[model samples]
Each structure stands twice: as structure tokens, then as C-alpha cells.
Target chain A: MRINRRRYLTQKVAKILIWMAALSTMGVMALIVLQVLSEGIPVLSPRFFLESPRSMGREGGIFSTIIGTIALTVVAIVVATPLGVGTAIFLGEYTREGRISRVIRFGIGCLAGVPSIIFGLFGFVFFVIYLNMGWSILSGGLALAAMILPTIICTAEEALKAIPYSFREVSYSLGGTKWETVTRAILPNAMPGIFTGIILGVCRSIEETAVVILTAGSSLIIPTSLFSPVRTMSVHFYILAREGISMEMAYGTGAALILLVLFVNIVANWRLNRYIRKRA
Target chain B: MSAIPSSPLKAEVKKLNFYYNLVQALNDVNLPIAEKRITALIGPSGCGKTTYLRCFNRMHDLYPGNRYEGEIILYPDQLNIISPKVDPIEVRMRISMVFQKPNPFPKTVFENVAYGLRVRGEARRNLLEEKVEKALKQAALWEEVKDRIHDLAFNLSGGQQQRLCIARALATNPEILLFDEPTSALDPTATSKIEELIMQLKKEVTIIIVTHNMQQAARVSDYTAFMYLGEIIEFDKTDKVFTHPSIRLTEEYITGRFG
Candidate 1:
């Protein structure tokens, strides 16, 4: 295994290229975080959080948008988590070799690849227009749930795959049935990955605006029911930025959106680290 | 040792043929496992010794595309165990297995041993504690692990993990115990310890062990069955099998001429 001069030179080049690619991206993320923090800090106050959405010059807040985003995310989590985890279990445990499983997997891949605006168009026609839901929170949540289902399913499947087969064998040998083994052993072992999947799904859903904008109308008042019109943080930011609002409000809202995304990533990373520690 | 029946031929197999897909893993294998004694199945890799041992309790049924045709008769009762309706779980409960590699459940030492009892609905705190302690003592692991009964089983050395597996098997009070190359993954010291444990355990449970180590078979087993090409070449008392095998293949395998 002696290294020649040519090989050594190539190795050095490869190392530099790898670091360059990694550091460049890391630097961009850090710069974005710093920019958001420096700009958004002055705009955020305890009172701002409590107030409702309103036009500037007249005075306004993001209360309705915040509540709507929370509601949409909660519904999405409930809908996606079970379906995603169950699909993961089926792929990991029951699927050995089959055309159907392959088809299902390819379908998920294509679903994830579909553009958000296209999804918005479909939701706008299917749920909001044809179903006559009339810009409702339920319609928005279901649309977002559809958008993020692929994320949850893929991550959860990987987590289930990461678990050792020996654990399953041990459980079976001890007379644990398939369902018992899945719930007690497989799911517990894959919890970190599953949690990561969920958080990522939530983050992606929250960051999306096109789909929410079409399904959940730009109502400034707080949504009292699922059928009522609502607005999310992303949609609010979009409306504010596009409608020629004061530059300060637009920049501040953008920064707030960035912070929200960062918060979700942090929680997901913590869960992932905890899972890795357990595995180790 | 005193608890085991003195009778010989506790379990018997007849005309057993095991196939993995179209490839035959075992062919018309018949043998008797005596009570209160160790029977070692010795051969090279792919010789079907492990496969044959797995058939005693139908562990082979775990895999798809595997088919077995034969009668396995349990002595005294003369039970025909090859029927598809026979529950593999019940068979496993009565005849426990120690895998080739040490596989302790990812749990505390106490939980690992008590797993078998708990599966059968034995949840009394006092009884569960006593069984865990007794099984550990039987496997000669009590002295090393008694203080850390609550410690994770994965933290132990390979030998300790193997013993813990043995202890887990013993907790079920199986009438027969199967070992599939139990010491192949262990060091010399651990191998010797497991060998000693096997010798001690044979006094109560019928033992059927698979081994690549000829010396281990000679040292611990009462009888040895030599297999090659998925067929038994010779089977007799351990001394006779080593000293004067009936088949040339058996002699060559025993003499380390080929695997």
C-alpha cells in the first residue's frame, strides 16, 4: 500500500476539493443565520407576538399567521406520522422482493419530486374549488400533509433499515409477535430517525407558501375553525414582500421565517444525536 | 445433573432430509440424542451439521424456500415432530438454541435471562428474580455478573455474552439444548469456559452441539457425528470416530486433510 507521488498529489487535490465544497456551504448557512439574527432582533418584541396580522402604517402583528401555521403543522404531523411509519415498517419487515413495493417506492419518489406550485394548483382546484371548502385550514393542512408525506416515509424507512436484524431475531426467539416486535423493538430503536423525519417534514411544510396561499386564503383574522380562511408565516411573508410594504417589515418577516426554520433543524439534529448515542 | 432422567435416547430423528430451495442441506439424517450426555455434530462449513441440529426443533422453518421431509421422534413419548401443524414455538420452548455468534438481547443482564420466563406470562417479581439468578449460576456467570444484574448485556465481553445466551436458554427449562458452533466466535479462554459449561449442563439437559473444533468434540462430547457433502460420513463414540472412522472422508476431515 505504498503511495506514489502521482497518487499523493491526487489525494491532496481531492482533500482540498472536499473541504472547499463543505466549507463553502457551511459558510453560506452561517452567513444567513447571522444576517437574520442582526435584522430580526429589533422587530421582535413580546407585544409583537401577541398582536394579530395587520397592514403597516396602520399597525399590525403576526398572531393569526402564527396560530394558523401551528394548526396546519399539527394536523400534518398527525396525518403523516402514522402513515409514514407504517409504510416504513412494511418496507423493512414485510417486503422481501416484490414489484408492488418497488412501484410504491417509485411513486413516493415521484411525489417528492413534484413542484410545490403544481401541488398548490392541484389543491386549489381539488379541495378549495371543486370540494367547495372555500379556503379552509383543513384543506391547507391536508395539502401540506401530502407535500411532506414523502419526507416522513423516506426518513422513517431509512431508520427502520438501520436497525440490526439481530434485534428482530432476538425478539422473535423470545416469543414476541410481529406487531409487538415492531412497536417495542423496531420503533423504539428507530425513534431518532423517525423524529428527524417528522421534524424535517414539519419544516418543509412550514416553509412552503405557494400551496398554503392557494388553499388557505390570506385572511388577517384568526381562524376559528378548520373551514375558516387562514394565513401562515410563509404566506404572510410572501404577501408582505410582494405587495410593496415597507422594506423593514418585509426584511423582518423574512428573518422570522429563517429563525423558525433554524429552530426546527436544531430540534431535529438534537433528536438525531440522541439516537446515535443510544446506538453507540 | 440429578434432575435429568438416566435413560438414554431422549430424542431421535429418522429419515430427515432438509432442502434449501433445490439444494439439499441434509439427507436422510437419523441420530439419537441421549439424555444426560453431550452429542457433538462435527464437520466443515456447509456440511449440514448445523442444519441437521436446527431440524430437531424445526428452527429451519424460519427461512423461506426451505423444506424438510422426515420423522423426528422424541423418546419415551415417541412424538412425530415433522407435522406442519406442530407449533414451532412450542418445540422451541421445549428445545432451546444457542446461536453460533453470541446474541444477547439489548437489555440488562437480569432482563436477558428473565426474557424466556416473562414470555410465558411469569411476571411474579420474586419468581422472576430467582429464575434469573439460578440460570446465571447454571451458566457459571453469576460470580462475574451478579453485581451488575441491571447492567446492559452488550457491555460484557464476548464470552460473557455467550454465557448470558446460554443462561437465557436455561431459564425456559428446556428438555434439550442445541448449540450451533457455540465457541467458534470465542477466544481460547472463552471457548474452554463454554466447553466446561456445556459438560456441566449435560447432566440435566440433552445436548446437541455443532463444532468445527475437533478437540472440543473429543474433550466434551460423548458421541461424535462426522458429516460431509450434507451427509453423515460416520457417527460413533467420540474416541472411535477420531481413532478409526468407518469412512475415508470422515478420517480425512478428522485428520485436517480438508474441511
Candidate 2:
């Protein structure tokens, strides 16, 4: 086939435009990361992480914030992983193409697409007021778990679906029951996919501010129990910015949050890549 | 080649039918598989060869709504193999299948062959080791893989993986072994090796193989059953089926006139 001069020129221009669009997106992300680190690194001191929250210009640490973030995230993962994975298993294995599965899938898709602000509002009204677990880690963690559940379920379902049927057949050919095949070959083979979802869930939970603000409360001290007041790193960053704290301190906390997010992405992407390679 | 026992046990299927939803995969299939004979089911794609082969071990029953009607008597008086009250697991223990594509679990080579035995609660370490070695040797892979038994099964070549699967099946001590196009995914050299192994294996256990490869069927099988659409067109000694077939469809399929 021969290319016309006009068509060739148009194609060349289109390709250049596409490349420019891709490169510009990457460039923006790089600039933001660099800007945050450069401006915030100067304010990052050991005392910033060790001391308790206090008034403007005074030394304070994020120990309570860090502990609360960890506590809430752990609880969220504990609640979400099983429910999400079990739902995925049912969708992928037990449920054939049917109306109920389709409806459930639609519900999950909608949940995933729902904005973070909406989840926060729901948590604030339902868990905080209706359920009367106001500003509690339990409420915050449950809300975060609900927020990330769809993501976990969908990713896990895809992973399970990717496993070859022959693996199940081999297990069954060895006289293993359906449950045995799932727990043994199916789950093990799909572990990397499940792990990827978990990593994404953890990353989202750690960065979530709106949901934590409403359900977890902004108390500076560490929470004594699940029902006690709590504050996470993201909420802390927001409070630091709005409470007339130094811009340097707010930027520093922002940079730390960015690093944690970056670290989670790197680890999750590496694991996902390794899993794909092993399967290949 | 091992002389068919003076009075060998027979595997019988009586007016069996298989349906996948509205479509019939197998229709009114009736045959007796002589003990220790290599019976090859030769047909084109979607002709129910694999479907019929899966019935020997009740492998198809696991998939929902893939129903089988009628009796598949492994030794007679065993009741219908597809009966809901009967556990397919027990049926599988006596009849194992090797798939078209070699599928080795993501485990060490030694563990691959020892899986079936271990699942049966045969826990004696020495016995397990002996069985693994014996099964691998029987599959013609022991000498090559003995030193690297700890290596991951995925690291092996496709042919080695297929042989490993064969070894795994052998470890189960099944009365019958089913192969659904065992060499269809292998290269010519690998295909020949598997053919040779099948020829050897038939001496120890009854085998029902489904293959599109007429040459392989000619080379490995003792009895050949030619199927078309959803019916068995012809079943006879391999030589008769290939050289002097009873039905025109069987002759045409074997002679490459048409599928």
C-alpha cells in the first residue's frame, strides 16, 4: 500500500500530538513530586515525627497520627480482605453468567466509581450519627474498608479468572474436591493478584482524608480503643494546613505522605509485575 | 504388547449421552474397552472425543450442567458413574487424565510426581520417594530430572512438563489413564516420545486416548474408534480402522478425504 503525502503528513502530526499528550502528563507528575520534596525536606526533623501536636511554631511530633493511621489501616485490611476475596471467589468460581452476578458486579462498579467525598458523607451521617460511633477508629476503618472493597473485589476477581482451567482440572483429576482445588491451586495461583488489590487498598486507605476527618476525628493523642477519637496522617496534613501552622511544616507532611504513597506503588507494581512474569 | 490377560476385565459404556446445555456432545455411545488395551478415539474438533474420554474418570461432572446419561461401568455392577449419589472423587482416583496441554503445578519437580500419592495419605517418606522415582522412570524422565528434582516444574520444557504430568498420573496407581490429545501441543520429536511412552504404558494400564493426529493413533493404539459429529462411526483393531474401515465417514476421516 502506498501512502498519500497529505495523509502521511496528517498521520505524522497526530502521532506527534499523542506523544506530546503522554509526555506532558508524566512531566506534570514528575514536577509535582520534585516540588513537594525540595520544599518540604528542609522542615523534616526527628522531632517532627516524635513529638505530640501543639500550637503554631512550637515543636510537635506525629506519633499519635502515625499510630492512628496504622491502626485504622490494619483494621480496614482485616475487614476488607476476606469479604472482598470471598465475594471475588463467588463471582469468579461459583456464580455463572447470571442476573444476580451481573447486578452485584454493577453494584461493585458503581461503588468503585463513587467519589471519596460521598463515602465520607455516608460515613459521617451513618456511622457517626445513626450508628452513634462518633469519631471512632472502628467507624473510620469500616468506612475505609467499604470505600476500598469494590477495588479489592474486582482486582481479585480478575486475578482468579486469569488462572487456567487446567489447574483446576489437574487438582480435580487428582481426586480433590472443588473446595480443595480452590483453596489449594486456585487461591495460590491467584495470590499475586489478590496481593496487588490489597496493596492498592492500603495505599488508598492511608491517603484518605475526607473519610477519616468525619469518622476518625482529629484528636492529637493516640486512640485508646476502637471507639476512641483518632487522627490519621492525611487528616493531620489537612489540619496542619488549615490551623495556621507554618507552610514548611504542612509541605513537609505532604511530602512524607507522597513518599509513603510512592513506596506503596513501587512495591505493589513490582509484585504485580513479578506475578505476571511468573504466570507467563 | 503384553498379552491381553486370558480373561481380562472390560470397561463398558451403555447407551451413554452427554449434553452441554442444549447441545449434544456425545450421543448413544456404546463400547467395551478391553483391559490393558490402548483405545484411541479419533475425531475432528468438537466431535466429543475429549468429552467421551473425560467420562472414564468423571472429570466432566465437575463442570455444572455438563450432564452425562447412562452407565459407564468400570468393572460392572459399579452402578452408573454419573449417579449423583456417587462421589466423582472416588471415580477419579481409579481413572486419571492427562490434558492436551502440559499443565505442571507451580511446584518442584519431585513434588509434581508425588502429589497424587501424598493426597492419598501415603505418608511413608521412603515409599513416597520410591514411588516418585519409579513414576518418573516409567515416564522416561527420571534420568534427566533426578538431580534437579527440586527445580520448579515451570522451568522444564513443554515435553518434560507433559512427561511430568504422566508421572503424576502414574503415581495415583489408576486402573485406567486417559489422554486428551496428550501430544497435540508438543513438537514432532516430543510427540514421538509421548507416543512411545503411551505404547509402553498400555502394557501396565488400560488407556483411552483422544487424538486428532491420525499418525499418532496409528502408531500408539491397539483399538481405534472413529467418531463423526456426535456418533461413533467405527470401532475395531487399529489396522482395520485405518486400512479397511466399515463406514465411509471413518475411512474418509482416516484417509484425510474430509473431517
Candidate 3:
């Protein structure tokens, strides 16, 4: 009876500790969000979203930065998706687990762990200077694409692996060529997973600052073409806060960035759920 | 081997051997498949029945280092199907398979039934619809799934999914249908329904089924090959093998004395 009581007491203590740990994590996230939203929400207005910034962002709005962010992100995603997904398919389907595949996987793992600042440095050297592209969306976008390729490849490969081998067999037994089996049987089922990876790449591209500032140039002007220099919202926020220009605008930019990420995640999850339901 | 079917030969396996890398899976497998008839392979687990069945469409070729020796000669053309010169895709176009599990593609019921036809370049909408309907009816699943034809194949019950696989395999009107334990994953009712469907299908196409259940072979097969340890112990008429055994090993296995 005494031992049982002690055991019950230990269980109660462990439960409380776990609950405390979870509550603290949630508390930290909530506090940060609340702090930013409290200072930022007041600055948001229709003009703030629609008009371009003036006088080094102390006046007017952040319209130019928003366009720059969208353009850079679009370029990054467009370039990255095919290369990443194709690499994943080739790695997962075309080759067996051999020394070459292992080396490639190791290279990808190393790439994933490399710091974002190194990507910025590489982009500044290879694309901005060496290629003489100057400060442009194309250079920054290519840099961002390289940074996110490993993420997309790893996730897409996992999704392809999750599919049953029997699906391939069914396709083959139906007289499908290898390419046909991949397109018809494998790729369709892997779409949701691939989409998730693309979304992650988008999120990373949107918030990235070092690569954009170094290669794309932190110009406040709205970009006219791929070759035009521009500023993204995250870069804008970093400059505002670090240069002691406007903490209010920085907070506002930070809040908008958070909201954008959240919206993208919610829409992606909803679409994925609807697709899964229809298939189920 | 002594009791060859009286029907015309569809394919013949001569001195066939199979290997997964260095591990020999089938050894000296010789059998004759009759046209428009059902031939069932019965054996213990890992006895090479499914491996032997897979050789028909060169499924073993999909993986590296898996090798096939000797010939599987198809009739009329008399071409060696397993030869490196003959494309596996061409052989697969002439033959189709229904797996042990209900492996319906992640597609709608109608699309699942129409996949093989589309693979063969059948595109006209009206033709696809007609052929899909005919295949579904042939598998005896048209009435149950007609209203929900656009619904996902995964929404169907286990038995219904298996039938959909059958319809998918039958869509291209394959000359031979290979079943790798089609009913092993089903309940008794579903099993009986599949058995009935298999028996009925033999009138139109040559069938090579691998089954673990001895009774299933007896009920649906015209000829039965009993395999043990990667070799065929006996190949004879179903009734004769089940009743009047000529080999002691075959008798022991049929009477449930040992595998």
C-alpha cells in the first residue's frame, strides 16, 4: 500500500513536469507574437500596403518591398521546384542504393546544414560579381533556390519512398514504361508531399535577408524586371531595426511577415486536406 | 508433368530457373499453360510459386541482379518471352496481373478501370467509357460501383477493390491474366466471390494463379502444380492430384501430414 502510494505520487510529479514544459513552450511563442502585434497593428493601413515608401521608409508605405518579396519568391520557387523534384525522382527511382547515390545523399546532407550566410557569400561571388549580373532579383533568386534545394529534395524523396512498391508493380504489369510508371503511379501520389516541400522553400525565400541584401541589393525602389535591384520585406525590417531608423516600421514589417507565413501554411494545409479527402 | 491438359498450349516453361542475386528462388520449373484455362500453383510459403508466376511478365527484371535462365515460350509467335531481346513491356502488354492485395491506384473507380486502356493509348472519351463499363461488368462489380464511379478507388471495400484490380487488368483484354494470391487478403465471403470470378474468367483468358489454400486450387483450377523448396513436386489434373496421388510427397502434403 505504501509503495503504491509512492508510485502514484511519482506519476503525478512527472505529469506536472511534462505539462509545465509544454506550457512554457507555448507561452514563449504567444509572448513574442503578442509583443510584435501590439506595436505593429497600429501602423497597418490601406495606404501602407498600396503606396511605395518615401524618404528612406520614414514616410509613405511598404508597397515596393512587398512586390520585391513576391517577385524574388516567385523566381526562386519556379527555378527550384523542377530541379529539386527531378533530382529526388532520379535519386529515389532511377538508381539503386549504391556508392554514387550515397555520395550524392551525403552532399545534400552537407548542403542542408550549411549556414544561410555562406549562401549569401556564394551568391555575391558567383552570380553578382563573377557573372557580372550586378544586384538583381535573378542572382538573389538563384541563390535562394540553391539554399532550398536540399530541403525540397529530401522531403520529395521521403514522399516517394512512402508510396508502396506495389504501385510501381501495378503500373509495370499494366505495360507502363518506367517513365510512365513514375508519372502515372508515383508522381501523382507524391504531389502533396512535393507541395509541402515547395511551400517550405517559399517560406524560406520570403524571410531570407542575407542572400537578398548581398546579392539582390537592398534598394527601396520597386523592381521593373529580373535584372532590377530591389528590397524584400525581411531585408527592410532588418535594415530598419539594425540602423535605428524606425522600430515601429520594423515591428510592422515583422508582423506582416509572420502573418504571410501563417496564411500560406493555412491555405496549403487546407488544399492538401481537401485533396486527401477527395482521394479517400 | 505426366497429365498434360488436352487443350492447345498457350505457353511452355522449359528448364526455367530464377535467382534473386545469388539466392536461387526457382529451379528447373517446367510446366505447360493451356489456353483459355485456369492453372493454379499451390505450395508452402517461399516455395517459388509467386516467383514462378512473376516470370511470365518478366517482373524479376525490374530489380538488379535478379536473373532468369532458360525459356518461357509463348504460342503462335513462339517467341521466348524471357530473352533479353524481347522487351518486358511488350510481354506485359500481352499479359496482365492482379496482385494478392487490392492495389487500386490512387484514382477514381472509373479511372482505375480505365488505366490499362489509357496506357495502351486509348484516348477517345466514349471508347474509354464503354471499355471501362465492359471490364467492370466482366468483374461483376459494375452494379455496385456504377453510381459512385467517380469516387476514389480507396473508398471501396477490400473485396470491391480487388474486383476493381481485376477490372483494371482486364481492361486491355490481355491474353493471359496472372493472379498472385488474389484472395489471400480477403474474408471467406470475399474469397468465395473472387474464386467464383476466377473460375468464370478462365473461359476468356488463360490464367496462372498462385494460391496457398489447397481447396481454392481444387475448386478453381483445371490443372494444379504443387511446388516445394523451389521445385515442382507434381503437376497434374486437380482432381487426380487431390485424390489419387502418384507421389508420396504429394500425398503427404495433400492429406495435411506435412508441408
Each prediction's TM-score against the native?
Answer: 0.90, 0.92, 0.97
Reference-based lDDT, each prediction = 0.83, 0.86, 0.93
lDDT per residue as tens, model 3, A1-280: 9999999999999999999999999999999999988888898888988998888887778999999999989999999999999999999999999998999999999999999999999999999999999899999999999999999999999999999999999999999999989998999999999999999999999999988899899999988899999899999999989998888888888888888888889999999999878777
Candidate 3 chain A weakest lDDT stretch, 10 residues: A52-61
Model 3, B122-162: lDDT tens digits are 89999999999999999999999999999999889999999
Residue clash pairs of candidate 3: none
Docking class of 1: acceptable
Across B1-259, the per-residue lDDT of candidate 2 in tens digits comes to 1223233555877888988977898999887788888889998888889889888878877667788888888774555677767799988888888999999998789877887887777789899999999999999999889898988899899999999999999987888899989998899999999999999998888999999999989999888888878788788888878888878788888888887
Off by over 4 Å in 3: A1-10
- Candidate 1 lDDT, B85-182, residue by residue in tens: 77777777677888889988667899889877877878899999999999999999999998989988889999999999999989889888889899
In order, the TM-score of chain B in each prediction is: 0.95, 0.95, 0.98
lDDT tens per residue, model 2, A66-97: 78888889989999999999999999988788
TM-score for candidate 2, residues paired by index: 0.92
Q: Which candidate is the best by TM-score?
A: 3
Extract clashing residue pairs from model 2. Answer: A51-A61
* Candidate number with greatest lDDT: 3
